[model samples]
Target: MLTPPEKPVHWNVDDVVVTEPDVIRRAIGAAAIGNITEWYDFGVYAYFEPTIKKVFFSGLGDTVGTVATFGLFAVAFLVRPFGGMFFGPLADRIGRNKVLAITMIMMAGGTFVIGCIPSRASIGIGAPLLLLVARLLQGFSTGGEYGNAMTFIAEYAPDRKRGFLGSWLEFGTFTGYLLGAVLVTVADAVLTEHQLLTWGWRIPFFVALPLGLVGVYLRSKLADTPAYAALEKESEKREKDKAGKDIRTLLRIWPFLLVCMGLVIVWNVTNYMLTSYMPTYVSDTVPNAQGGGVSSTTSQVLQIIVMAVALCTIPFLGRLSDRVGRKPIAWTGVGLLIVLAFPMVLLIQAGSVIGVFLGLLLMGLALICFSSTMPSTLPALFPTEVRGAGLSVSFNVAVSLFAGTTSVAVGGLVGLTGDLNWPAYYLIAAGIVGAVALWFLQEPNGRRMWGSAPAAGSQDEAREVVEHQDREAVPA
Candidate 1:
């Protein structure tokens, strides 16, 4: 029986007094846990694509089986938009915590189930079928996870530091990838290649269970953001109010959604390129004559190093965005990638250790632009009511069309054109799309969200409205 405040509460973090830095720390940490688990699972599948192809799709022959496995991987992305459509409105209606909790469970369960599945040698065609089902479940849940988590973090952030705080979410994502790389690298070291194909590949999948539980616990202990809580209070007052907005009205903001889609295209392409496909590309395509194209083990380690380098810079760019504004910092990253991605591919093709390291390092830095600012930028595109759904739909649709299929597309393009630099052309094209979209977007840095202000009340009353945020800071 909460009453609506006389006026809508401004969702700015400054309005809520924070006596402890831990409040912000805990909030950011809680939001990031799910992201870590989500990306860990994705990274495992992508980084281990070679093993996965050998294990599940062996019936198809070497090259075609690898291609088929990637196709199945892309299938998960196809389901992501549906997950967003189903879960995003529910999150906007229910609460971010509840949605996050559900998504983590689904993601963890799907990943663990993949580990438990019988190998193709034992199950015949059923192995890959079961694997595909598991992936779809994981992908579906992930659709809800990213938007809800990003919006949850952004809403909790102070205006001045939203970009910095949001950057941590991507940090979790990269850390997941890093951890996945570590697991594969360790497996490669401990197990012979046969053992790796037989059992080692499943180890990373099994890790998702415990990781997901931690994510669930972190999200469950938290209170909803003051902004979402405010929305709930108002929705209760207007009993006839619904969580699902008309699709027509949402579509009217097509330009905004398109801009988000374009940015996602840029982000996902760069992300999958450097983090997921780069290792495989370098290992498979680098010239052996020049001491290029290291073994799979070395490739995994190299990717870990590159991911580590990129991850370290994310926090800095996130903070920088807060000062210079989101657009400029984001554009700088995209611009650099567009110009350098092609050349970086050339270096990888050169087959020298120095060239490989320099190419990946440069590409990693370029990716940080989108990675650091994206959490702050995407959520700012819509007001609170439709924010979750808007981002979920737009981002997933773009990612599915571009990022999800990037590895497969690159493989095909290379086979078709016999050019190792096919990825460069793809990345550059995505960058152009991003630049065009950025032009149409207004910078939203440090701006008030939802056009909300303190309810018609005294300053003391507004302060009271946000007191729950501090109260919820008590750790579970």
Candidate 2:
């Protein structure tokens, strides 16, 4: 266990011991791997939609097959809120390490099932139904995976360097996304079209089984957060009272809740609409030509490359935030996306593969600003007691409201307007929401890790209520 600080002192990176680095490093590594596996499993559905439809929707026309497969992909995003709710307080109540392990196991199991599932030819509708179920499981697992991973890294980090440390979790997500894209590109190059749809796609899904086992093992060795440590201490002190406290206490702080919701919308819109939806947008617009100016495969390969480069740069930028502060880099990231995301789409419309690459590269860089800062900054908004629950509720509500529907909404908008750039404006609106939230958010510089507030449990907020009631009845 982490020993208490010499005083009730706030943390700073410079003060971290040589041993604490190892702890944070280990946590970051696990967090990164979880993201990598999560996206590796999720992104494949986008890149391999052609293959998946071929296997499962064989008799359907090309247009319908593509639609159904994309629909399934969208469904996974829809399940994120439930996953966040299930995993969030589970981690808060039980332990982060235990919940992390359980989540990875669930994901690995889901991926393994996806790998083993039979197609329409063999089992007909059951195949697609089962596939949707597996995707939902994966989606739900991911919901909790990210929030918890970010929370783990943020709580472990020294306050001074929190931005740098927390951003690694997002860096992990992008890295994982790139890894999935690369795997698809490489697997396509290696296998014939006949072989890939038949079996090669399964290879990627199954790969997670072993990787997830390793993730669980690594997480098993991790210690609980200092915030949780203090919560456990407080819980023990107040053993006589065992009352769950979440929504009522959270709603009392409505301003912070609104900010959190807006932030989530921005985060997910840029994430899904830009990263997940881009490949499809390119497939629809850029023709696969004789010279390969802009094909789906080529676009995916470029996306993989862009994501890889962006993921690498994210850590450096995140570390920069540690030096300068989170908001500057973060708002700049959102602002860049707001300014460039639309123009980048128009560049693609101008008809060049180079333009496509250039567009995504700019958007990816801009998206990283928010992605990197969020892991550290969002968690700092609340004290530790209800950190997991508050984040899950706000994040899920925002995502369900904005994110889960973003791809579907964008696709519908495109069909209606005959213009892909319509989605770009949507991205800008999301960024503006984030910028607004940042205006009110506090930077938790030098804040004590524990005992600052009743973030984990209700005792602190609950006691406040009792005091208020007593004062109102007696004297007011």
Give a tens-digit lDDT track for model 2, residues 184-213. 778888999878877888887878798798
Give the C-alpha miss distance for residue 112 in model 2, angstroms: 1.9
Model number with the top TM-score: 1
lDDT of 1: 0.78
**Cα RMSD for candidate 1?**
6.4
* Model 1, position 193: C-alpha lDDT score: 88
RMSD of each: 6.4, 7.7
Full-model lDDT for every candidate: 0.78, 0.70
Q: Model 1, 75-104: lDDT tens per residue?
A: 899999999988877777666677888998
Candidate 2 local lDDT, residue 429: 84
